[model samples]
Target: MQKTFKLLLVILTYFSASSCDDLFEYHPNQIRLDSDERNLTATNLERLQKQQPGDTLRLIVMGDTQRFYDDAVDFVKSANSRFQDIDFVIHQGDISDFGMTQEHKWVQDILKDLKWPYLTVVGNHDLLANGSKVYQQMYGPLNYSFTYGHTKFVMVDTNGREYSFNGKVPDINWLAKELAPQQGEVWQQAIVVSHVPPYDADFDRKLEASYHHALAQSNMVSLSLFGHIHNWNTDYLYDNKILYHGTTTVKNRGFTYLKVWEGGYDIRRIAY
Candidate 1:
């Protein structure tokens, strides 16, 4: 009787310990932040500042990381393992639920564990009321450009007027001038990254056609990528150019990884 009681106590202790471990595991791989708090932290700012030109760049493009924050974290972890040399990460918008401060904080905490530089584009959901201001304060600029290795990467503001239908969808003039091949430019490849595509029904029809036409003339543009559709695609808008609309980090949609070699670029999807 004494031996049986002791054995039962030991088993109970073991199960209790296991339960505690599971409780604390709190992987939160499925949790996402709200909209208002998507700003940059001291660490993310430092990483962004350290990036230099002419480095082999490996980046993960994630879409709609707001409601599916945990899934996004899972994707990030998987990406970190596969692309050990990634210089940075680009999130193509929807970083939060309501663009609230709490949401931003949650995401920042999750991303704090990542070992590489990461940045985000503004999405429609991220623009809820004061979302743009919050995002700008957190990540720096809305629309900007950076050069890496033999590529010129442009991050633009497509969600500026997401709350309404206006002619000022994307600054087409700015994009055209930026895409112009400069004298002795070492960047043989150019890519445009936007939160919303010109063809997305969210924008005004006139504005979409105008922006689309402008992009068609930019011969230097090798790839045009967008989010907001919540799925992966390879859309060819022109003969020599291709547009890629990657899926979301929500609903376990996965991420888009691009490999740019001397010959060409290859995009692959990873399920987190």
Candidate 2:
């Protein structure tokens, strides 16, 4: 009887320890950066200097990297080595599981090590509490647009309503004006980057309606890029356009590589 009791206690102790280990597993946040890390460097900036006209630009895209901070770091490092000649980077948001300040700092710390320019759009998890303010202060403005290689890249604030208004980013009015074609432009293509996609069921219905219409009407748009679904995917929204859905960092443990020429682009996933 004493031997039986002792064996039971040993089993219980072992199980308890295992449970604790599982409970204390790594939980990645935005601010948990490496101790030796600093922000982006001059060399990194130099690497992103504007490309000459007509050059084939290479950019990399990453899906939801909110959790798995170490995985995110590893992903970037692996991608850097493989895509040594990349021009720019774009993260599809959810850099944090809770959009907390610490999570943002952590991810940024890892990101600053990249030898290329990078951009991040907001994700659902990134808009939790005062996330927008933290994101703006740490990163930059939302709903901003830039041009590269005859391609117009629009970063829309899809989580605008997360604060108090509608999650309807890409302000229909502003986007309408931005999407308006400029005279003398030939063979223009646009890429829309957003956190929540128009087809996401949990997103605001009214906002989705307005934004979907706006995107469809944006005649120059060639692709809509999003990452909330956490899977490798592509959808044909229009005859001339396709929506590229990126996979989550935790799911596929990979990122997407993009090769863009003057008129078209090719994207593929690179797993670690």
CA lDDT of each prediction against the hidden true structure: 0.69, 0.69
lDDT of 1 by residue, 88-141 (tens): 777788888787645766677677667786777778887786777767776667
168-219: candidate 2 lDDT, tens digit per residue: 4547787766777778754377788887776666456567667766766877
What is the alpha-carbon lDDT of model 2 when measured against the actual structure? 0.69
TM-score of 1: 0.76
